[model samples]
Target: MRYSVSEWTKSGSPWVWLNAGAVAICVIMVVGLLGLIAMRGLAHFWPADVMQATYTQGDQSRRIMGELVQQEMVPAEQLRGAGIQVPDGVEEMRRDLLKVGNRDFSSADFVWAMDQGISDKTLPEMIMVAERLEWGNFYGYLREVRESGETVARHDGHAKSPEYLAVWDEFQRRIDRVLEIRDQILTIEKHEIGSINYELERLRLEERSLELEQSTDAEAYAEIEARRAELNADYEVLQQDLIDLYTKINRDSFTAEIADGREVEIDIAKVVRAFLPNKMGTGEKMAHYGVKLWEFLSDEPREANTEGGIFPAIFGTVMMVILMSVLVTPFGVIAAVYLREYATQGFITRLIRIAVNNLAGVPSIVYGVFGLGFFVYFLGGSIDDLFFPEAKPAPTFGTGGLMWASITLALLTVPVVIVATEEGLARIPRSVREGSLALGATKFETLMKVVLPMASPAMMTGVILAIARAAGEVAPLMLVGVVKLAPSLPLDGNYPFLHLDQKFMHLGFHIYDVGFQSPNVEAARPLVYATAFLLVVVIALLNFSAIAIRNHLREKYKALEM
Candidate 1:
């Protein structure tokens, strides 16, 4: 039987339907947003066929070679306004953004061309796309391979010629050799020499500390000098090794014929990978895509974070959130326990609850400013002055760093934890406490054994919320610690293992820097989306871990609640 609208409202069915509808809409929007991000971001890794075409504008016909990045229909008026001569009868025109990525040879990495002017478009098997260490991708044909300034192999005009295949084979072998050498150089510099440098710095600091303390220890000075000598010897050896590796890596060079029919010599050291998209089989393409995706996740960023992977940013974001959770949970729980269990329900307590609620509403940037001022400058400076006087003139803790950023986020998210924990505490049946007390248990023991165990799921819920918020936060991190690029990870093989005093990268900040601060907006656009999707995934992973714990806790304490 159909109910009247008033009757349905009276029965609360309308409100239920409304609430369900709202929830459904929210879920749909969120899924759609994630889908859009995934589509735009993930497609960047796939190898698209590079097109060779003649682009004619007015009287000048030029050869254009690049991947077709985006296509859009634009009003003829807009095209004409941009000084392009649109045909008179055309009301709208299709424009294609081609990623013509010989950045060193071209004025732009990406150029928009009217579809009408694009002629003789073909996916030529000979077209090679060279992913580079700098200046972006190079779309060209491999013309010659040179070793130590001597011509090793030269490509003929024919694509399938034996000479061309031999040249390609030689190029691949040289690339493999260069890559192996590059890895050795990186290892020597980043780890082996890095350790030596770290020890040398520590020695210097020790020497300074002794000087500050007015120590006359002759043996100490001698020891420091001997250590310094050893380090210098190690550095020299590594330096020589580095020189050799560089010489080897820079030995091979290749000449490529770009779209404009100009031959440019590119050192093998600068080329990251070279692939012919048109010639690649499906399996090869898949393998290439896998490697690219892995690099995006595992490698260090290059070219102002517009290219390369965001591993550092990912590491920093996760580390900060973990630290924030650890710092916030106990303090928040203690505060909540004192408020809900120990304190008298009076005006003062009410005032505190009000204050805690209000703290949640404060602007995140305000938290950032406060963190920069108090946590970074004031507290950190005081610590540095007292404990690290030897490292004077150079502020150690008195700067934006991992520890300060973590603490700042802890403070920012504490209110959420406190409120959630207090609610959890309030939900416990008083009889449970009374029963434990009646059985000769102390208030603390009863609270710990019975009440807390039952309330842990709520505490975890709070922690989950805190993690969700802290992980995605970028503004406060910018002030407190996050940098555009961190040369080294805060956590590494160095002594103490974790260097909380070091500034670190965050995915949110990476996205911001790539999306807005990048010099190449077109190049960075897909990266921004990809990074955003990864950020979401990271946050979800953190939240899911907390949720899993919460679920376990809930299960463990289900009987008591019943």
Candidate 2:
């Protein structure tokens, strides 16, 4: 009853099964990868109990305290090769990765401790984890809370001590106040006084422009000076306000005992957050997790992007893709329309179609090189020289920036749009065009009114494909406009809010930086997973929006279809 290969092919059942299996495999792989990323990334925000343990090595014992990161069993041969003594009968040695914070005091923030050598492990309910602004986290016992060198709340690291609760309440209040004042200072520095500084610079540039033109009239000079005076006055007031706020913030301090029995005084202003994870209930832990997750999403990164939120990267990535979409759509649609509708059927047109297809196959790095050479250097340099000569020797548009990145991505993805759009235009019925012409509509009107409306869904399809490609591109962005860290966002409250020439961060570049470029690879690993998950979500959202528009257009033009 066995069938021949030709008979099986003729039946088509084998091919159909093959296709279904392939699709299932592909889907499973995608889901598995995403699940792994989520497990690693999202677990970083959860509050884990601090283990205060005694770690012994070579006849020396030291107190070690931090989060238990991971555990593994390693072959005895491996440990012996690394100069560690192992028992003769033991086949393997157990090791635990401990996140021993206080990087400032220790050589490393994370270390591997042999389970055989470690003893006296305890989870102390009074142990506190202080997330600081620098040097990563600090794990210790809260000692004394002070204000202006006067003891306010003192604790002896006892679970039944009321002083610990008082200290916690007072510290929480001060932290809230510090955060409020910090925001005020940031607003003034980055926006209020920032606006003044920007205006002053603009005035200086204007004066220089006038001087270059040999038109530095007395009246014009006086007007510029007047504006400068106003800006300076505003800056003085803001400077005083900052000084007062700084004084207020530094007035509170606390002392905490580290794992090694030394108490260190920490300024309240330096503490980003303080939490007692061992004392928290399930509901409290969940609430804390939610807050931490929110902070990761909304706060600007600190400590080399291993800490804080990735809002800037998220914003920059979305902004760049939107700009790329805006630039690619019209150019691709117009080129496609000409090729499909207006151009005579000829060899040259066919060659253009071939070239467009070939462009899609080119490596993204090649596009990056072209963008760097032609867009950033050649075209942008010429623009800066012609229009921004007053700021010579300092590049304005003649450097990697947001606009150049968008344009580079648009150039890279235009081929997809053109191909999709041409296919869409080809699907239109010949009678639809003839009918519009018969009704006295010009060729342009027919394209604008009848043909394009029916082709709207296709344009959106092209845009979706373009966005999908552009959002994930990291190599070209690195060469053109993406940076390790941008001090300011491209869009801010400054005058002429959208500054196209400013450099920006991107999620793709951020992932590369954190995963590969970070000094603390262990600390940064979870962030890599989290950032990757977020990037996938962003791409999905962008595609969904385009798909929604395409669906609407398809329904509207259903009557026009043949």
Best by TM-score: 1
* Per-residue lDDT over 107-194 for candidate 1, one digit per residue giving the tens place of the 0 to 100 score: 9999999899999988888788888999999898998999888999998572667888788888888888888998999999999999
Instruction: Give lDDT tens digits, candidate 2, residues 260-298.
Output: 899888888988888899999999999999999999888
lDDT computed for candidate 2: 0.92
Using all chains and alpha carbons, the TM-scores for the candidates as numbered come to: 0.98, 0.96
**Local lDDT at 55 for model 2:** 91
Q: What residue runs in model 1 are displaced by over 4 Å at the alpha carbon?
A: 1-5
Clashes of each: 0, 0
**Candidate lDDT values, in order:** 0.93, 0.92
Pairs clashing in candidate 2? none
